[model samples]
Target: VKVFGEFEFWFALIKVVAIVAMIALGSSVIFFGFTNDWNPIGFSNLWQHGGFFPNGIGGMLLSLQMVLFAYVGIEMIGLSAGEAENPRKTIPMAIDSLAWRILIFYMGAILVILAIFPWNEVGQQGSPFVVMFERIGLREAAGIINFVVITAALSSCNAGIFSGGRLLYALSVNGYAPSPFAKLSKYGVPNRAVMATVAVCMTGVVLNYFVPDKAFQYVMAAVTFVGLMVWIAILLTQIQFRRSLTQSQVAELAYRTPWWPYSSWFALAFITLVVVLMGFHEDARIALVLGPCLLGVYLAMFYIVGLHRKTKLSREFK
Candidate 1:
């Protein structure tokens, strides 16, 4: 576990460094004209094309699917609560920083992209970052962006594996899965869980080879639904978790979600809206169906494998 955890940590570090570098370089180009072809492009381009909401309210709403995926890993900080040196203090500090960090990273990057190019053409040829660099006549900028994107993909995959592995380990420990899966390897890694995750991700590589570009987009859309499910689960978990605690305990919480039930419900509604929007877009519709289907299958397996029995035991104990 330690080795695998360290591996994931380093992978995440690489991704953060690459993104920071891209942001710094991209911002500098906008601040100072990189070449004659690209004058010091300022904020004017944001409204020059079709205005800030060129795609209108609908487009902005649709863009949330993409934006939400970028924010998926934000909750990883919360998951680290159990291991934190002082979770009460650290968790609140981390959550406190989330809003600003997201606004600066996602919104700031999008703003830069829009400022540098028309919104319609932002992702047409490729990534907006690559396009921006190429426009500036930076010889190796495209390659650099490509490299960064590769690192981003790796980081995402690594995080997914780590998260899934831990989830599976928890399930196994709770008798929801085979006990053997809960056993750690010599290096303390949840080897079985990691192997399972790697197997699923390897299928992605195969799909990439056989189906290539279109497959990736379809997979991304489908996978996004999993994100929505996870968010809903978190909200539900928090609600249940809080319900089991005393009023005093709640009041003492260092990192309480603001607005209580209202904020939770609002977030839930937003997630539902994203799902509905996915149905409107032909490419994302498959995900809407597949996501539910996958959940159904998991529930069925839970019952069939006697996990339901264990759950009943837990409830009885509670």
Candidate 2:
């Protein structure tokens, strides 16, 4: 697992460097008048046709749910906290980097893409990355994008499985899951936990075989809300943790979530708004329905198996 983690770290670094390079190149093409054969493709399409908020506030509101899912793997940092040598410092750095990541990697790329191509034509032109490359006379644009997309997907999937397996192992150790899930492989990996996670992911693979066109959409519609719920729980837990600490202890801490309770409250309100927005959108309704039902099952099991009592007693004795 250590070796695997090292490999993932390198792979992820390469991924980020590549995307940043692309964004820089694209921004240069858009602003400088050097890339597109000295024809600066300034930001006209942004508001030329129908103004900036072309689709209006409704479209922006609808996209909020999509943005929540976009930040899915951010929580993987929490999973790695147990192994981090300087988690207090490193985690805050990581969290702060997310703002820049969203700004540079996502928004910067988006602005570059929209500057070069109209919003409506983006989908019809295939990937905007490939389009930007093609505009610069890159003959291998399609192949390059294909390779990058594959690597990106593999990296994201690897991170997800690795983090989730660790979480399952933790749950098992804490008596929330089957004891067998706590076992580790010779490589010091949570083999059973990883296998179980892979099995769950394989359900999507199976769905792809049967319903290729709609598999991703259906799965996303059902599970994205769960990701938001996880995010909200983490935020709430952070607030509670801050409350548990003395003001002196908090001031002594090197790293902390910014704005403390206000940040958590704002995030909770934003997430709740997204969930409510999900109710208004047709495709998003699936998540709203399934998300609550899933939570209900967890709550029911907590009561049925006396996990709350078990956990309370464990904490008391500890």
Residue by residue across 1-318, what tens digits does model 2's lDDT show?
Answer: 676588688777766776887777777778886556778888888888788778899999988877777777678877777788888888888888888888988888888888887888886866777777787776475467767777777887788788888888877777777789888777778899999998888888998999898787667766678888887888888888889999899989878667767878998998888888988877788778878988999999978887777643223110
Query: Using lDDT as the measure, which candidate wins?
Result: 2
Question: On a 0 to 100 scale, what is the lDDT of residue 309 in model 1?
Answer: 65
By summed lDDT, the worst window of 10 consecutive residues in model 1 runs over: 309-318
Best model number under TM-score: 2
Deviation of model 2 at 189, angstroms = 1.3
The residue pairs in collision within model 2 are none
- Estimate every model's Cα lDDT from 0 to 1: 0.76, 0.79
Off by over 4 Å in 1: 1-14, 29-34, 37-39, 311-318
Residue-level error in angstroms, candidate 2, position 106: 1.4
Report the lDDT tens digits of candidate 1 across residue range 50-133: 777877898888777766766766677766775678988888887888788767666777777777787777778988878877
- Per-candidate TM equals 0.87, 0.92
